[model samples]
Target: MINLTINGFEVEVEQGATILQAAEKIGIKIPTFCYDDRFKPHGSCRICVVEVEGARSLMTACCIPATDGMIVQTESEAVVEARREILDLILANHPLDCLTCEKAGRCTLQDLCYQYDIEETSYDGARKSYEKDVSNEFYTADQTKCILCGKCVYMCSQVQNTDALCFVDRGFETHVGTPFEQGISESTCVSCGNCVSVCPVGALMPKRREKYRYWEVDKVQTTCSYCGVGCQMELLVKDNKIMEVLPVTGHCNEGLLCVKGRFSFDFVSHSDRLQKPLIRKNGELTEASWDEAYNLITSKIKEIKESDGPDAVAGFSSARGLTEDNYLMTKMMRAAIGTNNVDHCARL
Candidate 1:
């Protein structure tokens, strides 16, 4: 373990730990934009700059290793000024459309601006603008709102192991896009929406949610029921109806999801969902009350057991059911019906 001083407080950390990691361990926050725990650190933003004693210039805390007996000042006046200037440079070329952006309330850039009390853009520079690319059915990309932090690029190419996005040009004209400048729908993109989840600003957003602002909806955190992957997702509800789905970080899925788990949740409230039991009468199907359906099933099961023995009855389970429900189904099949032939299609 290496001992260091962060913000005048003694902290012990691993030998190869970064200054940002040590500060985070000691409850000292260093603002950052391009650093994600799940991805390799790219110190391109320069917002986590900190002053190290005996150093000639401020170093990026995210990339600088914490050495023993090193003294780091996270929030000195010079450090704060440098961070504000870096943030100003980022905001100079960024679009000023936060009110209607999908990442409005949850945007990291907006939070950092508020933290530094930056009321306006200090530099009057020409803002770069790009046409909104909505070619993909699942998501849209607006390069004007992009901070060039490479979060989406790292998430798609490195973390998810899907090289669906990459830097396409050189220098100031560089921007993230698919190969051959093809639309995401025309490329090998799988529409997992991991890039959308990691975007710090409004560059990447869900296509279905473009009509409404983020603050106009309610977010409900719930476990995904699609597969046994057991990923955590947020159901964006509006007016008692589901609007979209967003994956949560550090969960079972690591903020990544398949197409089925991300977009197939509309079946939850589909009109074809069975709300009540159905019975066949006079060669036609008719809706029946719960009590009537229960009685009919019970009578049929009793008749089968009495005539053909308990082995004549069987029950099937579904994988979509909760764990407790599956457990109860197995218990009832073995204990009540005394039938070992009972099984579930989910077992296949």
Candidate 2:
């Protein structure tokens, strides 16, 4: 264990813990622009710079490991000034279109600027004029809004294992995109949108129907129904409509979702979606109440069981249903119905 004093609070953390981790253990909030818990910290943003008791200069809290008897000040006067300057430099080139950008409510850069009381950039520097990459079907890449944090690049390459994006050019001209600065559609990009989830700014925005503010939606946790993997996810709903699908870190997917799991949730609110139980009468399917449908199903199943035995009434549970529901279906078939003709659609 290593003992460190972060913002005057003495804390102990396991060996190899970073200064940022130590500060967090002591309830000190050190803002970071390029830190994502899913990957290793590279400390490229320098926004989490902090003052150590005897260090030569400010050290990035995200990357610098905490040492025994270390005294760290995460929000000291010098550290705050350095962070403010870092935000100023980032804002100088970043586009000031938060109101129009869909990422406005959740943008980390915007929050930092507000925290440091920077209403606008003081530097009138040259901003990148790269056109938006609308080639990808799932999301768009606006380089002008990018801060070159490399979070998307790291997520795509390290987590998704697709090296579709890389740093192109150098210095002020640098931006992350498909290899050789090619369009996302023309490269090895899979449109998984994992990179989009990791992005801290409006540079990578998901393409969706209508815009939504963060506070306008109520998050509802549910499992992805695209497959039987049972990946945990959250449904961002507004006015009884699904606004977005965000992956939740749980037993199955661990905060990562595939292209279908992330972007194929529109069907939930489609007009063609079936809401009521349907009964086939005279070869025509008609909507029926739940009680009526249950009565018809019970009579038909009992008739078939009496005429040709319980084996005649086979039950095929769907994979889309919950695991517990499927288990109950199997139990009813073997115990109550006295048949072994129960199976799952996944087998077929």
Candidate 3:
């Protein structure tokens, strides 16, 4: 264990731990942009700069290894000024359309700027120009709002193991793009939207949410119904209508979701959803009230029991239903209907 002082608090951490990790252990928050816990520290964005005693200059806490007896000041004036200046530089090139951006309220860049009290840009010049790439059916990439932090690139390549995005060109003219400058729709991109999830700014956003604002919907936390992965997500409901889906943090998904879990929620609003129960009457289907449907179902079960025994009555449950519903269905089948043939289509 290596002992270090961060924000005047002495703490013991594993040897070779970065200052960012150590500070995090002691509850000292160092704002970061390009640092993901699952990825190797890139240190491209210097927002996590901190002052180390006896060092010539401020070092990036994300990549700087903590040595024994090292004293780190994370909130000194010099450190705060350095972080503020770095954020200002990032904001200088960032787009000023946060009000309309889908990531406006949840953006890390906007949160960092608010933390450091940065309200206006100091540098004034012609901003970089780039067209919005909406070729991908799942997401949209706006180069003008990109900060070149490489979080999307790292997430796409390292996390998802799909190298759909890469840095193109060199220096200030460099930007992220698909191979051959092709749109993501024409590439082998899996459309997982991990890049969109980790993007610090509004550079990458879901394409379905282009016409909506951040505050225009109500977000409800719920478990995903796609696969057995059970990833958690926020269902964005606008006036009782699902507008979009957003992934929740600190859950089983770890803020990452697959393509189906991210975009395949239209079944909730599908036109075929059974709003009312239907029964065949005189060889024609007719919508029935809940009471009538239940009574008919009960009479059929009684008839089947009297004619073909209890084995003829079968009940099927849905795996997508909640735990309480599953338990109740099992209870109703075994106790109320006296049937052991209860099963679910999901099992098949």
What's the lDDT for all of these models?
A: 0.85, 0.88, 0.86
lDDT of 3: 0.86
Model 1 residue 98 lDDT score: 73
Superposed model 2: Cα runs more than 4 Å off: none
Better of 1 and 2 by lDDT: 2
Candidate order by TM-score, highest to lowest? Answer: 2, 1, 3
Tens-digit lDDT track for model 3 on 1-348?
Answer: 999999889999999999999999989899888999878898998988999999999999999999999999999999999989998888788877767677877788888888989987899987787999988888889999999989999998888889889999997788999889887887779998888878888899887733666678898998887654578898888878887787787457888888887887878978998899999999998999999999998898899899998877888888777656777988988998788878876779
Q: Tens-digit lDDT track for model 1 on 1-348?
A: 999998889999999999999999988888888898888888988999999999999999998999999999988999999988988888888877776666877799999999998867889967777888899887899988888888888988888888989888887788888888887888788988888888888899876733665678899988777654578888888888788888876458877777766777778788998888999999998999999999999999989999999999988887766677777988887898888866766678
RMSD of 3: 3.4
lDDT of 2 by residue, 128-172 (tens): 888999998888998889999899999888888899999999887
Q: Alpha carbon lDDT of residue 59, candidate 2?
A: 98
Model 2's TM-score against the true structure: 0.93
Q: What is the lDDT of residue 140 in candidate 2?
A: 92
